[model samples]
Target: MSVRDPNPLDSRHPKRVAIVLSSPAISTTTGWPVGFWWSELTHPWLAFRERGYEVVLYSPAGGRCEADSLSDPRDPSRYSDTDLISLGFLSTPKLAALVEATRPVSELSVDGFDAIVVAGGQAPMFTFEKATELQRLFVAFFEAGKVAAALCHGVALLRYARLSSGEALVKGRTVTGFANIEEDFADQAVWEMGALTRGTHLMPWRIEDEMRALGANYVQAGLWRDFAVRDGNLITGQQNFSGAATARLVIEALGG
Candidate 1:
């Protein structure tokens, strides 16, 4: 219910963070291309970087990862047109290279990083729930008393990850992710796009629905607000707009 190990992590020369991202995938409900969200990844990365934390981008299978087109600042949709952070990140070759070819999440170990943050996007709704390997890695960090965090639908991993005692990591804990209100809006947007879809539900599962099913005390701010809750070392953001706020919580927990 609070910081697991509050001792400052600054003893190390600039902390290291392992940010796991969802790789490319197709949406089952809408038959649209899906990947990580640009703002979710960039905002958090900047928060950590500005704190002098070394961050590494990793994918489940390793290789180039793509961002959901609508989340892209350069997209014609203008959904994220004002996202200068992602625009700056993508335009700069060196910083952009981070997500270009990510190392495999399987190669990661708690020994190499101070914290882990799973970014969310369209792909996560389809890929993260059944990602046992990602669940294991995330649980590893948490069990080791390290800072473990996730944003948006990426928090889906918590629904299945269990502690050594076989209890769900989120059981009876306080958390937040993409809320049902936000999901409803997303569903409407997809329907408005006239995608060849059978239903208005744009996702296989909703983050709020799943987390609540797991018995977590799911809390949230207004839709699209910068809300993040830190139940000890496990931190979660409300939605894409909450990325930097979530990362700041991690930074706070780490005493960065």
Candidate 2:
């Protein structure tokens, strides 16, 4: 439950991190509002802060960013109603302000940061892969031997992010993301709720399918279980629930 117990020296020298979120976008498949997942951001932010690391929020483009409706703790759908962590984050004026107005990735670089973590939601399926600057920053952190992590659909960056050597960053690495089986359930839930057709999909492509295509040693756990995979400086989480677990891997990799 610890957020930050600041070290006196932190002001002079802090371990800075860039936590990236997908920009606000209308989902092509669902035609619904989407951005980042609330828990995916709040949980990992808490984890990193607990270590006194300064976590800066960023988006593909600067300005206010939205959260997928279902991820909102106050949403009428009640999908994330039990997420007190997000509820607390949203209630706090200072913490909530972080996501409301994010700095654009294009305005920053990998220069001063020691790590980067990408949190995902419906928007990443439509935004992350094509945001060259975001991918570049993620890859640059890895190439510099710094911790680079992503959770849920955010892991999609690994599919398209390439090293300076001109090869996929995920190649030969063990990883996990939003799985195909979970995607099936998400589609089914929407169908039962009458928001989508029986055979329609909420995602244009499956994260599992693409990660497998990249020949990474992809693995996952039971539905909604907190699972994370760490391969060197690269860390990945299976879903939104895996945020803190994945951040711990990043902390370990940083020798915390």
Candidate 3:
């Protein structure tokens, strides 16, 4: 899916950005379906498109991408009503169609895009945590000096992603991701729904723990607040709230 610049006479080639999302996956702990977060994708998408960048959506396992129900503003739980940006994006049928179907990352050439932004959700904990291909793609973007970013659980990929130098991508770099306190709150919310009564942790490990173990200079804002960090071309956001901030940083890195 592509978004053309509003100006018809503009002949210059627009910047290209790729947004990688997770394919639908069932949460082992909750026994509920999970996928990409709505705000995490939509907010950054808006930021990129408004700057006249052509964005494409891709998935590790291509095809239709589902949004985590809790992140849907229309969900009965009303947990994300304040996500007006996603709501607005979802309201546009043509624009929303871009996420409904996605190409596989394997089909996308790294050199075709200037940057890549990995979207976050519960599924990333399961799908992206060990995705070697995604790890390679992200590392390529970083090594090429392009803007490479991952937010929230999407940052889980960095735990095992290695650079050509055989070091973890986040090693010795400042980064942020879903925090332990944030995970605690999420687990509490899930437990309230009886998903934890079956004796399973929402995620195998917290992103903060994994990054810190890899010697990353991990940082975070207060629980649930917007926070993002940029260490050279590597950009990361603390949680869903930081999506736009992360996208803006990418734009800055691209000199947009």
Candidate 4:
């Protein structure tokens, strides 16, 4: 992807976007960085900004956030290379500015945004498991008929989200997220390091399984490839690598 100019371009009509953060910080168990997965946040932010959308970053519990080091291009884990659009955004002052001033979920008004993106990392499972505020934000976005998306563990929120009629928002809608195999690979790495990797943080139950239980149309592309699925206004990307693809899908769904 080509790096674009960062001139102060404004949206024709500000299309507000609310991105939810997972604040649990990674575990020493996996030796991953202590924070959000880079691409899941950065890639989509870049895509939205490039298209002239106003992006807002927020955490479940507001504070300074961190990005996974392994997801950073500068990490030693580059041995297993990833084409991270995030790295590109991270280097830009305009994009980094958003991350610098992210607000808390409590401060976000769901109706003010055109769409909501739930970002993931190893931390989400721990942080978002029973987070009612985060769940409410997602539910509000879906209820308002705005584009709602989640990548990787962020998809876990969909498991708890319901419609106004008390039905699963994802019921009968196709969705995808980090698969069991990918989780296995991550957990194995931590085990090899002789660290205690928590099964809950890894692939406890595949998104497909829970989606099946919710009567969602669940699909998984080949592992670690850039893939995303759009089911009505709910767009879901499988993993970190799928962030950019998912963001474009959001723009397309929003009629950008």
Candidate 5:
């Protein structure tokens, strides 16, 4: 894919995008190390790059980010063998380097990009939740009229990201994230593996429950389906599978 130049005068300048990922964190409930989902990052990246958009990877804490092992297609556990998109992305040394050393969110200038995409995994439940800097950065991009997108657990960041007016960013907008049914399936899978108790939760709160409580019109498709919703400049995907769809929406929003 050809990278777009950022200069507006150049005619060939491509729109710029910032993809924020969570730094490595251990799931307190399941005691598993997690960061970003491989497909959540790679699929959207492929979509954006294919459209000739320039993308940069970022993290709240910077440095290398870990991928949730279950999201890895080559993982011996075979949970994601069908994820050929992520597999192809992982095999590309140049493209794979983007996740290995990410710039911290603090170093990014919101005005420099046309859009922002936040990728989620098990770690967002711990790291992205209540992240003031991330909240501000997302709000800045949103308030600037830039396309702001999030998928799966990454949407949890919207729970506390308030506008300068002190209102929740998702208050009246439509959005979607990892659904309750999907989470239940994941929990059951963990339980079957003896990694969690039957009644224990992988996350403290459900994304749907929280989004509803905040007054956002939270929508979901069938469990594990590739669902994405766009409300003007804000776009959200239902789960890891919806990444590319979500990215395409962002591209369309940017007038690509």
Candidate 6:
């Protein structure tokens, strides 16, 4: 009798997921204190925890993860009022502990996880682009046929993720993320005093532009819609609102 090896891509095993957060911690183009968004991080976390998947949080440079000021309940902006998932997450001491001791991606091996999710924030545009390590990690996962997901500004990585063949990871995949029009509207909003600052224009090229440039299938649902797309094993969400749905898509793709 011959013993066969287990197929790692098979979703029967308990999934070990690693989620990457921002480190340089600055807004995309505005220079504001950057961190993960409330719903973007918590909703997906809740979805994963509910499915009994083990979750690990990592930052590019490692350290405590910060929540964007706009997402803070104590902030007057109240930008995330409709996000109940974040509200509950912020209220829980145990759940709050994750941000306090998040491991740096430098200390972990992406290959050990079944899948990896790159969570977003206003800061991802700044931190993610320069994160060569993260780019490499994502490419490795993509080549290995593992599930890879990103939301909002986190999708910026697709611009830099090159495959072993020197092709972009999103070259032919359909995906979505924070839209340029939303950025324009956000900049015009009270968040900024109409200075047309750097962080205010960080998104630069919309997901549609960059994805289309690479010949990748790109779509934008709306300004702030809960839209997510799954291309093969790769999953992507439009914005913060799509976090939960994106996570569910990830689980479903894994055959849960």
- Give the higher-TM-score candidate: 4 or 5: 5
State the TM-score for model 4. Answer: 0.85
Better of 1 and 6 by TM-score: 1
Each prediction's TM-score versus the true structure:
0.93, 0.94, 0.93, 0.85, 0.94, 0.88
Better of 3 and 6 by TM-score: 3
Instruction: Name the lDDT value of residue 130 in candidate 4.
Output: 68
Clashing residue pairs in candidate 1 are 2-232
Which candidate would rank higher by lDDT, 1 or 5? 5
Name the 10 consecutive residues with the lowest summed lDDT in model 1.
3-12
Clashes, model 4? 0
Encode model 3's per-residue lDDT on 1-256: one tens digit a residue: 9997444323288889999999899987677888999999999999988888899999998888999998999889999988899999899999789887899998877899999999999999888765778888999999999889999988988887899999888889999999999988888877788867644678878899989999999999989998899999999999999998899898888877
Off by over 4 Å in 2: 1-12
Distance (Å) between predicted and true CA of 133, model 2?
0.7
What digit string (tens of lDDT, one per residue) describes model 2 on residues 56-167? 9889898898998899989998999999999999999999988778999997678878889999988999887679998888888999898999999999788789899998
- lDDT tens digits by residue: candidate 4, 109-188: 97688899999876776567668888887988887888889998789888889888999988988999887778777677
* Tens-digit lDDT string for candidate 5 (1-256): 9888552232388889999999999878777788899999989988888777888999999999999999999999998999999999989999788888999999989989999999999889898765778899999999998988999999989988899999999998999999999989988988898888789988878999999999999999988899899999999999999998898788779887
Candidate 1 residue 37 Cα shift, in angstroms, is 0.4
Off by over 4 Å in 5: 1-11
Query: What would the TM-score be for candidate 1 when compared with the true structure?
Result: 0.93
Better of 2 and 4 by TM-score: 2
**Count of steric clashes across candidates, in order:** 1, 0, 0, 0, 0, 3
Which candidate leads the pack in lDDT?
5
Per-residue lDDT for 1-256 in model 1, tens only?
A: 7766553445368889999999899988778788999898999888887777899989898888999898889999899999999999999999888888999988998999989999999898888766778899999999999999999988878878899899999999999999999988877776777763536587788888888888899999987899999999999999999998999899988886
